[model samples]
Target: MKDIYLLSGFLGSGKTSLLSHLIEQLKAEGLKPAVIMNELGKLPFDSKSVDEDVPIKEMLEGCICCTGAEKMEAQLQMLLEGEEFDVLLIETTGAAHPVEAMDAVLSPYFASRLNMKGIITVADCKRWIDRDKMTPQTRMLFMEQIKHAHLIVANKVDLLSDNEIALVTLQIQGLNNHAPIIQTSNAKLPLKMITNLEATYSSQEIQQAAIGKQLSLSSRLHTFTEPVNKDEFEKWVKELPDTIYRMKGYVPLKGHKNPFLFQYAYGMVQWLPEYIKMNPQIVIIGDQVESIAIIGSAQND
Candidate 1:
């Protein structure tokens, strides 16, 4: 059976940074690995950051555990059919729950082909402690991610003092005491240790637990295809409602030969030149995002 690793954590928890290092280490050991990167938004940036010539399947525009479950399974099937890799690593979006993510991966179709190594949850010290600022739903989602992990990586220790680290550790222990906690800044850990982390829960347990837990949360995905004026788009993005937690896509800014890739989260917006040109499109993810206000004139499709 092939080993499958699930990396789970909240947004900005450093899963991607750890993924890059893990990939490099795997390559150095002469082992081939494949990746399934789940993004809550349409445009995927983590896959591009891997910097490895390996099979990478991006399940975008929604969370793999919820809206993108079917697509993730399809991608997994495709990858399994194409090449044989020693192991598979799935990086879940920050909003993904480990139980649901694992449920999607352990579908009966891939039962014999994949053996789950373990679920590794990366907890951002700062973010984990800032629960008071999170919505009730968001806080529940965050706690759920850590509760199902076999190993909890308390990341960003460098950002905290010794006393703070202890406090954070105690808090995590309160939620999950069985999972071994590893401390690191930027999620740095021995690659071998990660590859060999023993799972606390079996795949069967994961599937069973995830059966009805999915219905507890409501997630929605919204896509926009029309291009808007660059200035107007920026203004719209700046004022996006708090209900919309994540947004990503490519936009054709006026006077730019290529469309720019945009990502927004936690009230911050980032835009950069895209190497590949594409029509204007954006995806928004959140709880009940019925619609977004259009800005500026639409460009010709």
Candidate 2:
């Protein structure tokens, strides 16, 4: 039977970072890893980070728990038939509800062929501290993710003060005492710690607990025709509404030779220089995000 692990987290909570690390660790252990990456945008930006040799199936333009569930089953069927992989790692969209995601993955047709490892949830330290500021629906969703996780990764602890870290840890423990919480920077942790975990909840429990309501979040994809001024772009980001939870993709700056990978979550923004030129596009995910305008009159793709 193939081992199956689900990567769960809120927007920009470092799921992809964890996924990359897990892939490397699995490869080092001489195990083959396959990934099924779900994205809210039309393009699969995160899947590009996966190693070329690893077989990947991208579920784009929808959350795995809802519109993409059928696609996910088909992808799983295809992966099972075409690949000889030891483990299957599914990176769910930030907007996905854990129960629903599990229900979708634990299809009766193939459940016997897979060993459900567990859900590894990454919680942003800062986000947890400021979760009260989130919308009621979003806050509930965030809490649900923590409540159902078998192992919780308290990521970005370095950014928080000593006291803040303690508070966040306590709160997480209070929310779900069943799961072991590991505090780390950049979602770094040993592979054995995760791969050995057994699913906390059974497939039947997940099916019974599934919440079928659609989340209010949406995503907008903007493709840039030319490089934009970095300063101007930063200014525009500063003026953005708090409703915009996450923004990420390759962005071309006027002075830079290659586009920089941009990531934004909550109110923080980061830019990492890319050595090679990438397609210039940005995916904005949030409540009512489609109405927002992109810089330089970029058209939505």
Candidate 3:
């Protein structure tokens, strides 16, 4: 059985930094691991920062479940098919839902092959407390990611004083009663914590718990695709409707032969490459706007 770990959190939650740290540890311990980055932008920096120089795979242009779901399974199969590695570390986009991202991995094909080792959720401690600054859509997605983790890594604790640490710990405890919380700076902690981390998914109790009923389970997708030239994909993303919370999957470009990596989180757009597969699978996850414009609350009252 291959060990697979899912790393998820909100925007700027120190996921990349922490991932680099963990990669270092994995290499030092003589483990030849593989990395899968679920990113939003054109910048290909996550590969450079990690120490191991092991194979790094990126799931670009949207949330895992929405757009990158297809490639995710294929990428995993590619890694496991040949020489199977000791473990697989998957880092999800900041705004992506942790449970939904994990669910995409288990979609029929890879369900039996991969082991749901556990989810390690990283939170920007300060940004989390100042939740009011973010839009309702961002906040809603943020809380879902936090609550679903098997272990919540409270990152950027250095910004907080001693007393602030305790307060943050208590606050996270209030939100999630299951997962134990750990504090770290740039994910610089013991590899022991991760290697021995317990799996949170229980097959027996999960059926009784009604997982499908959670979140905006029933969502209507409205795709508005424009022929975005190579140079326009980044700038064009800012113009996407605010109602579109997440946009990703696969998309085409003017000059590029391969389909460009595309994903936008609450208006922030990221473009890049699909080294594994070059096909467009774009999906937009948002509230179905009524009529020509949005008025009052999109939320059903």
**Strongest candidate by lDDT:** 2
- Candidate 2 vs 3: which has more lDDT: 2
The estimated TM-scores of all candidates read 0.65, 0.67, 0.65
Candidates, ranked, lDDT: 2, 1, 3
lDDT string for model 3 (1-301, tens) is 5677888887678888878777778888898778888878777566667655587777777778667878887788777786547878899888678756865665333443455566788988888778889899988888888877767899899998899889988988888876768898876757787666543223431111111122221122222233346455565556555655555555656565566667666556677776664434443334331212211112321
* lDDT, candidate 2, 12-63, per-residue tens: 9999999999999999999999999999999888999999999999998889
lDDT per residue (tens digit) for residues 193-252 in model 1: 675553222243111111111222112222234445777877887787775666555666
Q: Where does candidate 3 clash, by residue pair? A: 40-270, 41-270, 42-271, 61-262, 61-263, 62-248, 62-263, 67-249, 250-281, 250-282
Candidate 3 local distance difference test against the native: 0.65
lDDT, model 2, position 290: 50
Model 1 stretches with alpha carbons more than 4 Å out: 199-301
Prediction 2 global C-alpha lDDT: 0.80
Clashes of 3: 10
> How close to the true structure is residue 141 of candidate 2, measured as C-alpha lDDT?
96
